[model samples]
Target: MSELKIDERCKSTLKKIILFCTVLFLVSVVGAYILARGNWELIEAQIAQMMEGVMDNLNIETNKNFGLSLFINNLRAVSLMILTGFIPFLFIPIFILVLNGIIIGALPMLTGTNFVSTMVFGILPHGIFELSAIILGASFGVMICLTIVRKIIGKNTVEFKILLKYILKKYVFVIIPLLVIAAIVEAYITPIILMNTIF
Candidate 1:
């Protein structure tokens, strides 16, 4: 196929994959919320422990260098999602996405706070960019797995090298920038908003 046609095809495939991941993430969130409602104490403890572990790892004592720390942490996470695509059948990427969704869904219940307001003021500001980057990364990861499956089945597929180049190009050009903006907003603006409105 011509380069333009190939690019178009990639874009189309990416759109489908992104949509699939988005739906999966949403379902996971809703499922977790329902489950949490049924077993609030257990889920709350689990979520709290997970958050503690994450905070410990982040070691974010103050907001002075919070943006840089958060950016690096997010970069590592999204990069891992992409790397895990090398595993066949999209297992790891899906797990990561679902786990993230579960955490988000459980957050309001865990904090014993207003669900709508907490999500609106606490998560949405940075979540828009952060979640978009995450979903995009996971979609690319799924694409990698699909490419591998196609190659195994002797179907016509873009060479792995070309696919990797395209993924990396998009990661650097698109995902990284989104994450950078997300980290800045989450570290600086999100806290301020939450302090004023939610907290």
Candidate 2:
């Protein structure tokens, strides 16, 4: 294949991965929202129960380390998602995305979102980067699946190692940094904004 063809194929693969991420996120969000819409009380109760232990130790004063903690936690999750991308199947990565999507979608429905602009302003600071990293990471995971398809169809000559290297570079240089920024904003800035505006 020529350079031009390779470029086109790469672009096409990126488009497909993005589409997959969007579809999965939307589906999870809609599904979670629908599932919890009429049963918000139960969801709320469950959430409260889950947060009990954390809430007990939750101290705003001790949140000096919260950003770091949050970053590491998110990084761990993203790492898992990216690792799953090494698999030539969509099951695990998609499963992770689906579970996340449901949680993302259900949160607003369970919590009751009013004032769209204010809410967006509060969440957007961190959410934009965080969700993008997640979707992108998940896409990276699905890249192998695409490679498999290409090999079976005789369109791609790239070896699995080369593609894996590219994906790893993306994770280390791109996704990790985005998640770090998101963690900072989420732990520090987002809460302040929410406290002043939406909350």
Give the TM-score (vs. native) of candidate 1: 0.94
Q: Please, what are the lDDT tens digits per residue for candidate 2 over residues 1-199?
A: 5555665566577778879797878778777777777787778776555445333444345466777776776776677877776566454777887877766666676456652543386557897889888888778667766677667777845566656766777788989999989988988789788778766
- Top lDDT: which candidate number? 1
> Which candidate number would show the highest TM-score if scored against the true structure?
1
Candidate 2 local Cα displacement, residue 157, angstroms:
6.0
Q: Which residues of candidate 2, in runs, are more than 4 Å off?
A: 1-8, 41-61, 112-119, 148-157
Q: How does candidate 1 score on lDDT?
A: 0.85
lDDT of every predicted structure (CA atoms): 0.85, 0.71
